[model samples]
Target: MYRTARKVAVMGAAGAIGSNVVQDLLSCGVASRIAMYDPYEPGLKGAAEEILHCAYPDADVSWTTDAAEALTDASYVISSGGAPRKEGMTREDLLLGNCEIARQLGRDIRAHAPNAEFVIIVFNPADITGLVTLVHSGLSPSCVTTLAALDSTRLRAALAQHFDLLPDAVTGCATFGGHGEKMAVFKDGIEVAGVPLAEILAGRAVNGRTMSPDEWNAIKDRVRNGGAAIIKLRGRSSFQSPAHQSVAMLKARIECSAYPWPCGAYFADGPYAHVMMAAPVTFSTLGMTAAVPDGDDEDVAALQDSYRHLCSLRDEVIRAGLLPPVADWTSLNPNL
Candidate 1:
């Protein structure tokens, strides 16, 4: 458990994911105070009242439209503020609008809560939005991350189902690169009770069956498109899973867990150098320490390709003036 009391600020506290995140935080007793921010007054008020009524009755809960006020003195600032992806829209389609939202919030957070750890949950291009937040907030890259753990959760669940094992038994499953389709899963690094998952998958009778290459590809595709599949069925992107995953991430960061976990948009340098992309990161009181890739050649190449794709998208956003100037990003500290 965290030794010190924590004040958390949720930037889009009225939105679908934001509301769920607030509820989870209250349920988990993770925050001593929570400041909710949203542009919609009615929704914000309703969410605050409902959350207060249900849990953490004695906790200090407040709502605001002013970003700086909400972020003031916060230990952790989580931004789920952005446009949701509709049925026909890709996550990339939300880039410009969401990036703008992140930029404004980033500036406000920097001004008000410069020491707060930041987590970006804005959609479409989470990696780009995270980078924008890091640069605009003028915070060290280590102080910021995005929710790539959601993807890892989905992948782990998928693999667990395939192997007829509980999700908890499928250890070391990680998703790297962008939070989108280009992201790669490190199957080689995955294990089942300390045994390599690849070895088990290759065995003819392991778990009563073996997963062929084609079957593995199908699982990968499902994990990659899991968000879109949910959107197609429900007419909106996911909220519950994202909220749960975000809360878990906050817990890990607060407790300074040293185990490597998949972080959606942590800073990367070696191998895929100088980018904020999804990768395995060990969190401690000092902040993020990215794990170097030691997977097979194909997996490493895929990870690199994913990094390049994010770099291209980052360049595009910068050129469109949706993100901070390139000079600002290049001048910042490295992902230490």
Candidate 2:
């Protein structure tokens, strides 16, 4: 039966972060109908069962091994379906594996939840996975978003430490390339309390180390590698903040505020790069509307860099049979 009840679906809800996201969504009272989808699972007892057993035994919930069935009637879908970083392998290898997973989810969305809002959380290859989703889901590019903000959040935390201020008080921008070592974290136009970050960091000490652009670069590297660090310690991608972010993203979508947190979005040759960094956008009851301002040259450059990198990853994914090739994204990259 096609139900009228509003719903939210989390792919890989049986995994670490997806479980937390599902938990937070219920705890935060953000979704009345929550669905967990993991088609390869044995049965209803999935990754989330343990959490549900102790906490949300009576909450409205459903677990399915069918992605299409899980997504049906959902207003929003957030997926954390991918392998967490572990033993030695290049990022392209990660994207290849995750792209296949993302492609499967994208195909399910096309068949089951054509109009659903898209918010994917399968890290690292976020920008690339977003591209795969956009291509296969047959949804508007604007409807898709990825977990790029996780990186931005880490950048903000590092800056907060450098400036001797609360993380919330420090705002930073990251230029695009890849989600790895090559990424550019821009301090050129970053602000703290409405002032340049350079000024704010002039007085602080980070573990007996003085702050400098070089130090900031190191910090950004740490931010990019933060997830890998955790995986090393936990043998999985780990959890917590990602789950928190999933809820935050879901609320923004549910409220239609779209208020523009940095994320992954698809690009089709415009003033922006090929694959867009999720900008601060406003979401209304209708859909995604408006791009949040980066408000400067440096921020724009960072995003452009990411776009180029995304295109590279896009080619990599396409070659791996996870996505169709772009004839020539050059026609689509007006900014490049």
**Top candidate when judged by lDDT against the true structure:** 1
- TM-score (all chains, Cα) for each model: 0.91, 0.82
The TM-score between candidate 1 and the true structure equals 0.91
Number of the top candidate by TM-score?
Answer: 1
RMSD of each: 2.5, 4.7
What tens-digit string does per-residue lDDT give for candidate 2 at 165-210?
Answer: 7776665554344566546565656776567766645754443445
Q: What is the lDDT of residue 161 in candidate 1?
A: 89
What C-alpha lDDT values do all the predictions have?
0.76, 0.67
Candidate 1 displacement at residue 54 in angstroms: 0.4
Q: What is the Cα-based lDDT of residue 91 in candidate 1?
A: 50
* Residue pairs in clash, model 1: 91-124, 148-264, 269-273
